[model samples]
Target: MSNPESFRELCRNELHSGPTSGLLSGYVQANLLILPQSAAESFEDLCFRNPVACPLLCKTNDSPYRLENHDRYIKNGHFDIRRDFPKYNIYHGGELIEQKNNCVDEWAEGHVGFLIGCSFSFEYALAQAGLAPKNVVQGSNVSMFVTTKYLDTSGIFHRCPYVVSMRPYKVNDIEQVRQITRLFKKTHGEPIDWGFDGAQRLGIRDLKQPEYGDPIDIAENEIPVFWACGVTPQLAVATVGQSIDGAVVGHTPGHMLVLDTTQVS
Candidate 1:
């Protein structure tokens, strides 16, 4: 499962359905967000307003199930948006209604698919620096939390909290981790904050209870490090509430779509 094409085939055929971290190393991974065509423009504006959490890679309004001409990021010709992701979350009226292995039955003609930059894309570089995330080392999904900090609002999108992914590191190793991750500008560059003080600044009360993904145990000298997460959009959609007329689709937390390109600059 080292090759992106082969890994994608497993996803397409429903052979591999789990968190995508630590697999397909050296390749870029993306978070999927499929929105109704009517709200696509506003949602794009939201992404523009909040680039750290939602750094958009590429988007298409042509086909909901496939990417025909977009080869720069996703080089696989057989890539399908509906079936390539390990899991999908379906949201209606700002509430998650169902989780599915594939979105083949949920996607429609006017749906727009967006590929957002994921922090998972930068994990390979961290491992290269001997700062691999504990979640990757433990074979679990990264812990994610909805912070009290609010994102700058766009048209029809408001009152959304900034979601952050957490990783634990020794107090001394945090500086090196920050230095290494800062190079990945496209995939949530650097740590927004580290240590327990950092978590409090973001209004997170408890580290044990995460909104999404698994919680990793923190060692004696280690502290929780937080980063902007792609799941912010899913929270945004939920916070926006009844403003959206139709259902929204997104990749499940920690599960991402692997792209062929390795360039994150």
Candidate 2:
């Protein structure tokens, strides 16, 4: 990226080749979902019913993720969901079969984009409260796992197991994390479970082995805390094969969009 405007582009360049975490700071990271316009209304409605997993921050039209209106109000559907972010996945029958940097040429006429809320918001909030993510401090990505609990569903989209992200927390400061982060609706608010026992309840096999991101140091007496992840929906979108054969696009976890709107402080 040559300048600030090229931030998303730089993450794309790197993530297309490697992973994106701790690289794009202060940008509002997002979880992405792109589907045919035919399946969009149903999916959009699903997101509405389950806002936590599918916080529809924005949407764009069938075009490749883009924005043309400078002074007027804009629609996310207007942006091209394919190439706007770092990565794209082609899911066929609820299975992720392909991954790419962009899907402009691959996308057909009917497509819709969804930018979902991410953990970065709360992580940023945690850091502001002096809770440094061990992964971030160690220069690694977060560890994610699937739990036994299911997400509240809206038909067709059956109840799917929760996909959770774990970050290590010191035993001493768990309350501080709960106190400060509970108010933010944009991020996963507060802690659902604390300590390793909580992780075990979900049948998490390895406290150290994460399905995504890098593993970090878990100091003695430092318990791993889990939060409902945005990836939860992506997992559901994958498991329930009803709306499969469409281009699915998302931000590479950390390589988020730097939006013009700021939360009222």
Query: Top TM-score: which candidate number?
Result: 1
lDDT tens digits, residue span 169-218, model 2: 88889889877667656556676787878988877888877787677667
- On the 0 to 100 scale, the lDDT of residue 112 in model 2 is 69
TM, every model: 0.91, 0.81
Q: What tens-digit string does per-residue lDDT give for candidate 1 at 112-204?
A: 898989887778899888888998888788899999988898988888899999999998998899888888888989999988999999999
Candidate achieving the largest lDDT: 1
- Indicate the TM-score of model 1: 0.91
Cα lDDT over the full model 1: 0.86
Q: Where does candidate 1 stray beyond 4 Å?
A: 65-69
